[model samples]
Target: MSNPNSNFPLTLKQCRVIREIMKKGTEKEASSSLNLSQSSVSRALSQAEQALQVDIFTRGWSGAEPTSAGEVVISSCNSILQAISDTERQLQSNVTTLLKLKTYVEWRHLLIIEAVVKVGSASVAAQTLGMTQPAVSKTLKEIENMVQQPLFSRARRGLIPQTAAKQLASLFLRISPVAQSLQQSLQSLPNELTGRLSVGMLSFSCQDIVPIAFASIFKQHSGIRLQAMQGPYHMLANALRQGEIDCFLGLMRKGPIHPELIELPLLPAQYALIARADHPIHNDAKTLNDLVNERWIVARHGTPIRDYFESLFHSIDNKPPIQALEMLTFASSEELVIHSDAIALLFYDDWNINKLTPRLKQIPIPLPKPECTIGITLHRERQSTIIQTFIEELKLTIIDKLKTQ
Candidate 1:
């Protein structure tokens, strides 16, 4: 069974052949180690190189050696294999069993297991996978036999995943993104870049950099499709972890973050309290205490800006304003503040301040400037060319914007 939309360009056997070549440093040694004939190993390497559109190995009298591109591909293969090995260990399986599992497993098997686990019904999974119910059931049974474990249990609602099934499905979910990115990178030509990139945005702070960077990317690479997903930091972070989005742009959080994600700092962020130019509080309020009782518009809870807003009052030994409106959108917050007496805490960059000027003015109260960073968050293992290009554009945009300000 083959899917045209499958993200993995290479088969399991091809990956295994590549891995053995990497470890043995020669096709002959690799074939011997893997118990495969020399012709079979050569064919696997040739097919893998052709599929990826890159020569993974350089052949000579000594043996086959990996090229720079081959190194990257091998690293990705190692990660996928490591994930499988980890899952095997978690299930109390031995090395021999792990090797057998790797040999017998195909990408479709992983996809089927993920589908069945996600939908919890064979019929539904069949429909999702464009297969009949019997086919789905039979494939799942084959997978269970291979693993030597019952992956699911019957229930009135649907099939419930057992511990082994859950672990196996998790392995697929975690490695799928890495494998997809690897394939995209290796298969794409530099001048003809093509792929779909999903970026998650946290609130409006990302507006300053994301739009301009995306525009530059679109102008240069029309073949690439860019999509933006917006939500709070936690939701976006979860989506990034689950591989729903490739990367996120927004204020970086303080404290320990997910181990599987990496945060690259682009610039420092400063927050300011602002009010309408004609508001009475602008003239009467000399300190934060003076505006404590006035209506306020703040970011939604669990956001970095909101945390900073609350901490401002906490530092002064006072509760935050009792009368306040919590908002997530910059437009809504700006409109509410402009039409009413409500004040807001917002990004205080020169670009933002200039945009809000003549209508809204920063409150004169002195505030502490904490160390806050704004940047891109991505999967730790992801090193796709498209993602790198977008990040470069973001950095350039930030530098240019700062220079103008």
Candidate 2:
């Protein structure tokens, strides 16, 4: 097993100062907030920078701005801090529990826990982690000992993550992405080309740009492995932030909805309210109001697209359909709407429509909302070479295929 100490190589003071600077925004601000001198704050920042071997902040007259590397460091540091806070709150740290945890708990334990929860089996986690089953078990036992609770309940099907395990795993999920992004960053240093790139995208991207980019990316670099995960924007955005996926390609709201992740526009996407060709309102619809009684299929709750549907109704000063099914896949929603008496709000794509044509048609509702910007959402730390390469191909594909549409 890899040594745990090597991974968590930051000092206590370094952890303290990362938050201070992130919150207060500058050495002077941190010093003033923490009741320390400016030089102390500077030293703390410098020490953290030296330990991390990356520029965590750009110091200038206007204030401190985080560079890409800084963004990664801050993200990872925030996870660590939050995890520590959770541990303290749950464990109620006495001298012994505190000392035992401080001495025994390492970054690897959380990694193993998260892997187990993700894959739902110790054996699978072992295989994924390239460790023996016994080794993964031993690590989980160690984690249980440190936390003084059973994390997983052995089940007939798989390990059933209990409350403690689930909560702890959730905290680790936040950290794992930063750790993963860091590894990807190291792998994709400007001179080297070896790395894995995973992009999570939704329907609009799948209709054209993403696949085209995928083809070009594979053709250019046989050595690199490329993967894609499809889901709604909110789910994929959570994945992107957790480092579950590098970025999510789809329709983005015009302004900044998420400060941690940035959106770069790829194409203009216009919406259409679609129903099965035999749908009652397909020919008669004059406005959104004509379809208020129809059933609806939508992206999962809290998703940008699903929320956009809500905003669409509010924009027209109309009440939306009362019912919803949280089907995140556009294809699945399309299939359901094609056969059932429901309608879907979708980006206008002939490719999406052409395959299932004669069965599905667009409602004649006059949509007054502005066209949505379809694009990719990149986390603050996603400026690495491999990610950049993939995004470049996506843009090129857009220019060739989707720019006009």
**Which candidate has the highest TM-score of all?**
1
Q: Assess every candidate by TM-score.
A: 0.54, 0.49
Tens-place lDDT digits, model 2, residues 1-405 = 455434544543565677778788777788887777889878878877776676676542235656556665676677776666766566544324442443345567877888899889999999887789999999999988877767888889999997767766776667555554654553354443544567887754555567788889788775455667676666676767766577777777665466898988876666778788887786677777776677888776655666778887887788766787767666678799888987887775443434446778877777766366777789987578889998889778766663343
Clashing residue pairs in candidate 1 (N, C-alpha, C atoms within 3 angstroms): none
RMSD of each: 18.0, 17.1
**How many pairs of residues collide in each model?**
0, 0
Clashes in predicted model 2: 0
Residues 256-345, candidate 1: write the lDDT tens digits: 278988888888767888889898887899987787788889988888888888899998899987677988777778888889988998
Q: Stretches of candidate 1 above 4 Å error?
A: 1-191
In model 2, where do residues sit more than 4 Å from their true spots? 1-192, 203-207, 232-235, 254-258, 315-318, 349-356, 402-405
